[model samples]
Target: MKQSFVYILKCSDGSYYTGVTSNLSARMFKHNSGFYPDCFTFNRRPLELVFYCEFTDINLAIEKEKQIKKWSRAKKEALINDDFDELVNLAKKSFGK
Candidate 1:
């Protein structure tokens, strides 16, 4: 069975970038090497792999990547820090609490 990964990178500018790939090492190398000039990480060189999760299903990995891409920075950080309580709190619908 093939494995897929959803990863997040911390850029030089202190920003985050989310992506999915089947080859984590190769993808990290490409991102750090500026393989794609127009890629988000290209300009934000010197990226650090902050977090990653593997899935046996590529479709599920892709779905997770897309979902994460829509998350706020705080939410992403909560995930990276493995703070499940914070993640759940962030996911709640705010009601001016």
Candidate 2:
């Protein structure tokens, strides 16, 4: 059985990064250790796992990753904080509310 995970990392610079992987722990280790060649987190080492959601299906995980990647920084923060209402507010503001 294979499990996919959608995860977000808060970089040293306070920026958020969204990605999906089958091996979350291994991926985090690689990101922190710079073992994954040419990875986006290669230079952004020491990232903290701010958020993660597990999915049984790869497509669902990938879809969620893409969606999170498209979110605004405020929205991402809201998500990390588990503030659903804040996420709604961010979305409304994004649309010129």
Candidate 3:
């Protein structure tokens, strides 16, 4: 069974990019090489692989990718730092309510 992964790349510009791929290493290479010129990480080269999670289901990975894409930078940082509690706090503190 092929594994799916949702990964985060920390760009040189201090921004985060989220993506889903079956092969994490290969995707990272593609991002670094600027294979997708129109991609967010293309111009923001010199990215570091900061976080990743693997799943046996592609749907799950895609869902996670979508969820992360909507997150604020602060929440993303909390996630990257493995701060689940902080993530929950930020979610609860959302002003949109």
lDDT of each: 0.98, 0.89, 0.94
The candidate scoring highest on lDDT is 1
- So what's the TM-score on candidate 1? 0.96
lDDT of 3 at 81: 98
Candidate 2 residue lDDT tens string, 4-52: 9999998887778899999999988888988986877777777999999
Rank ordering of all candidates by TM-score, starting from the highest: 1, 3, 2
Which 10 consecutive residues of model 1 have the lowest summed lDDT? 88-97
Error (Å) of candidate 1 at residue 25 is 0.1
Can you write out model 1's per-residue Cα lDDT over 1-97, one digit (the tens) per residue? 8999999999999999999999999999999999999999999999999999999999999999999999999999999999999999999996785
Q: Residue by residue across 2-75, what tens digits does model 3's lDDT show?
A: 89999999999999999999999999999999999999998999999999999999998999999999999999
Better of 1 and 3 by TM-score: 1
- Local error of candidate 2 at 82, Å? 0.4
List of clashing residue pairs for candidate 1:
none
Model 1 residue runs over 4 Å out of place are none
Highest TM-score: give the candidate number: 1
**Candidate 3, which segments miss by more than 4 Å at Cα?**
94-97
Between 1 and 3, whose lDDT is larger? 1
